[model samples]
Target chain A: MKVKFLCIIALSAILFACNTPVTESEKNGSEQSRKSESEDSTHVPLATEKKVELKREGIFMFYVGAFEAKKMDTKKNPMLENKINIALDSISGDVIYGHSVVAGNIRPFQGTFNLKDGMYTVVAKEPGDNKYDGVFTFTLSPDNGTLNGVWTSNDKKLAVSERSYDLKKTEFKYDPSLELDGTYSEVYNSYNAKTEQHEQITDDAGKLNASQVELTSKDVENMYRRDLEIMRNAIYARHGYSFKNREMRYFFDTQVAWYIPVSTDVTAELTDLEKKNIELIKRYEKHAESYYDVYGR
Target chain B: MMLGLSTLKNKRKYSLLVLLSVYTYFLWLMIRITLQYFPAHDDVAFLSIKQDYVGMWHYKLAFFIHVFSAIFVLLAGYTQFSESLRKKNPKMHRRLGWFYVIVTLFFAGPSGLIIGIYANGGTSSQIAFCLLAFLWMLFTLMAVIQAMRRQMSSHRAWMIRSFALALSAITLRAWKYILVALFHPKPMDVYQIVAWLGWTLNLVVAEIIIIKKIRS
Candidate 1:
């Protein structure tokens, strides 16, 4: 009995250790079937032929340019070439791309477009000086007729922009309608137009705090630098590619006509308005050196 | 006076065996509950097999068989050597033995074989658990056959070995907790070593009991 038990144990041990050919084939066949089934189910969008109507809308366009530093050293904010352009194209029928040559070799250029009232994405590609590109998505509503959004980099809120402002003030107030909650439609419609026109009164002060808070030039520059460093690290780590200069220009150029209806009545006048906004942005760039001296790292 | 003394000794032996068997059954229940709720570790290999098999229909069928058969085996193994129970209710005891042996052959043994292939923690853990499970089924089969042939002593010895393997499920968990208490946050290496030692020790104790019974 003892010898039989020992022999049975040895035989069972051998059987378990040896992977027979039959089991191997069975495992492979099952894996292959699962793969084929997964491949069969892919999503395809519906194709529709109906023309969509867009309402007449106006957008105020301007550009904001700044630099970012690399590394977290307290001694000096390393001169990382991070430049960004923000163009608020207000009801502009023509899309215009322009560059400004400012003092201290700081040139900020932008492309403007008036998009239809719906969801639109603004992709600022390798915007000349910045090592990294940025993509911003915002909704253009017929009622609001403005682009109001915040820019964030490296998980930090960088800047906030509004339709009318040429230079983004550090201490600008925000309309409560822009808060992310689904309550924005009510706030936008219920406000007394006359009171808001005379006094910039926001409906919800506490929720709009982040938008109202002003960031110093130094803060903007620091944020820009950090964003650039993040981009550089991502590229070096083989995670993603940096946007080429031409690709950036092409995206901004293509989207302009879609935003600004070139065939409409507001085309010619809107073009001049955009040109003026560009000049105002350039003037701000001239004072940017002093802005950097006080605020830039 | 000598006859009375021998009877008392027999009574003591029977009582000790019964007490140990009952104690082991409760310990097995505790181990099962612990494993059901608080599993040993969450390694990838263990997770993958569990995801693919344990949660599937086929595996569920097998698991039910193994669990129900184990309960029967525990009951039968506990009362098999009970002198008073055998005298008072021999029919009931025989019925339980037959049920336990038959259920184990049809269900527990086959399910155990299927699950043994996917046992985690690599080859050694797989070998330890799979061999233990297979040996359990084999011993129970032999015991049932031997009892049918009226080889009562042989059947009893094999049943002891079969019960020993079943008790491994209990001993493994006990040793795990004991090591956990002693070491206070031991690593995977330490636990693996303990798993091996614990199961082997239980088998050795069962073997010692079997040898003693046969010699007597």
Candidate 2:
């Protein structure tokens, strides 16, 4: 009887957790609600009255969701998989316009963003007379300026589709003096060289900084770039890019749950993000190419 | 602690006071976090519904279960360790125990596991949280089983273990703060490390409590 009682109690708790005041009719709409009217896709952001503030500026990256492809003069890439790097000006807080290797080649883009009343709408337009546009809906993080949301293509040229997004601020450098080697090492050698020339100044600071660290203008830039690279690499691994083995596959196994395309087939159609990620990996490949040629694929 | 209580062992009395203090602080902190959702801050997963797409509602539900049920879990579980409540108000003990068991098994553990599958830290953090949830439910079930078998001591031991797992929520935040102060490590690193240590530390403390009882 006692065992039965305890079991019933446990069952009741489970039932209670599963139990919401939502009616059968609501349950019917739960499917609709999940596919939010915007995305018309499988998932939707929960609507809440919450507001978030975003004022800091750096490299804020976004996961591109869906795009309506138009077989126009320019090749239209439908799905962007990896992440779009947005370099926001710290002082102006505006997204710095630039071209990234997107779709098949370097695609030019323009965008406008607003932070008001806790809702974010970022508009991205592929630069041309006839432009493919993406309107993103974002929610600001309560702890940091991270924004998470979904976006859909609104251009008449493409299909109206949507995808989810994961956006967060990373330690960002406006620029990094990369060494062109597959590896991006910090540009501290020059700073160290400069400090060596000013040995007297270095000696003065060495007394305070017990570790005898070399301060460089690239400190913030290098730190952010290092973090950004890790994120990029993780995303690359997530999209099925094996880096020096299967280590990246299990990187976040401890912190986040990842479920995905469980097929071993690498012949899948790549997303726009994956294409861009492929462009990035080519750099590593270029350096490692010589090594791989000597060894194998 | 009830502030002016007497007739308890020194360790239980002091420990209860510490637990109450920490709990009160955690309650205030969580409440402050919940109320400030209007203008979401730039961190924490408090309002993921706003920008998240598609299946975000499930995450919201899981988070709600983890949050709301935790309130009752802490309050009801606190009274369970009260000697006076057990002796003078035995009926209340049983009722509160039922509430504790129900909320944990149904709401807390299951929801925690569901959301933990989507843990932000990736793999390591996911494993830690999921394991914690599973162990939480297991310990509570064992407690209930022992209680049914009329093994009061064994039941109490399991309850101690169960409560220790529940205490992870408190320790998670506490350890985050300490680790941040010590080394300004990245947030994910802190989360990964503290996620593992949070419940493990609590279980150790619970083991100490159990060992003390057996020795005395």
Candidate 3:
């Protein structure tokens, strides 16, 4: 009995240690598939019958679920349900994707569209600056983009499964009878989670409370950096692009960066508004050094 | 008695009582999460695990099976260690022991093994949990087999080890809190270290109880 128990223990240990799931990529050799998808194959927009200028920017909201069609009761299941916020550009038809402002706190997406033969295929990928990873493709309806598409990524390692989700989009701003009574502003606390730094919160008398922790110069510097990042992202979002500190890509550029993945369905061109936003961002960057110096960071 | 410690049994009972209370409290927490938090459909604060199980019915069912059976076994499994209860009420002891072993092997151990693979902090953490699951099942099996063959001393020792490992679910969280309060280690580092530390520490204590104390 003792020997039998010992042998069982040995077998069980071997079973567990040996069968710990390694990534399928290692087994299937993803190097080859990666090679095929590795190329920066930029798809140019094929000119169709005629161009139509969009006059109204619509606040688009999308509901996403993972590969479930009919019975999508997420409250009783182990699937991801995401609420995505985006807006379509009034002039260029480009989509501006915003962070979730809630859980998952997804990063900004710069999306472009291709309207060819009355079939609209839109592709959006997260900018390098964003902490999230994924590429999405949407098949847009003709009248306005009522979105239905698939969001896919193979990078996630959970269950060695890809995060291939289906999305449904509704244009929130296009409702004719919509009205707002009051301007709403969400007041944020002095301590920012993103930067792990605290800023001074002054009372009505403009006095910092005694209870507030004094910020070091380094804290001030970090806050400034986060502010700069938000402003920089705003600039990139204007042109339907994301900015990276190390190697950023602008839409107006003639060539694409090697790191930008191959997006087959997207087509975009630089707009006048993008050019203006770029100019403003550039001016701020040029003078921002002095501003930081004034803050003692 | 073997180690000339007259108070050994009392000491063991006291320590076991403390651990038993702690274990009961943690199980209550799990039950609270299932009944109150999950049903209310609350927003995920730090982790999205609630979302994961809530969004899929099969996963939710599996989670409940693992949780309910594991906690039930922990509650019932400890009573077999009482010397007075075993001597006086042998039938109740045998019945409860059978129920604990059968439910654990059939429901708790398998379900735990399934979920242990999906443990967070990446592959190393997953491996740690998987080994834990394996050992949990192995020790329980050894205990049952030893009982069947009338090796009472060996059976009790194995049971102690099995319950020690099973108590890891409680100790894992305890170690994480202790580590964070003391050192404030990185989240991933804390998770990985605590995952290993909980079961290893329990097993060490179990060995001490068995070798120096439980010989009869």
Tell me which residue pairs clash in candidate 3: A76-B54, A77-B54, A77-B55, A77-B56, A78-B52, A78-B55, A78-B56
Q: Candidate 2 docking: what grade?
A: incorrect
lDDT of 1 by residue, A99-160 (tens): 22111122222334445546343422214233222333333333433433333223222232
Query: lDDT for each of the candidates?
Result: 0.40, 0.48, 0.47
Question: Which segments of candidate 1 are over 4 A away from where they belong?
Answer: A1-297, B1-28, B31-49, B55-57, B184-191
Task: Give each prediction's DockQ, rounded to 2 decimals.
Answer: 0.01, 0.02, 0.01
Question: Compared with the true structure, what per-residue lDDT tens digits does model 1 show for residues B138-192?
Answer: 9998998998899988888888788777666566656656664454332233335
What TM-score, computed on C-alpha atoms, does each candidate reach?
0.38, 0.42, 0.41
**TM-score of candidate 3 versus the correct structure, residues matched by position:** 0.41
Among all candidates shown, the one with the greatest DockQ: 2
Which candidate, 1 or 2, would have the higher DockQ against the true structure?
A: 2
Best by TM-score: 2
Candidate 2, TM-score vs. the true structure? Answer: 0.42
* Residue-by-residue lDDT tens digits, candidate 3, A149-267: 65544344322122333334432221212211112211222456865755421121111111122322212221222232233333333222322211122211112111111121111
Over A50-99, each residue of candidate 2 has an lDDT whose tens digit, in order, gives 20112322223332212222222234433323233232221124442322
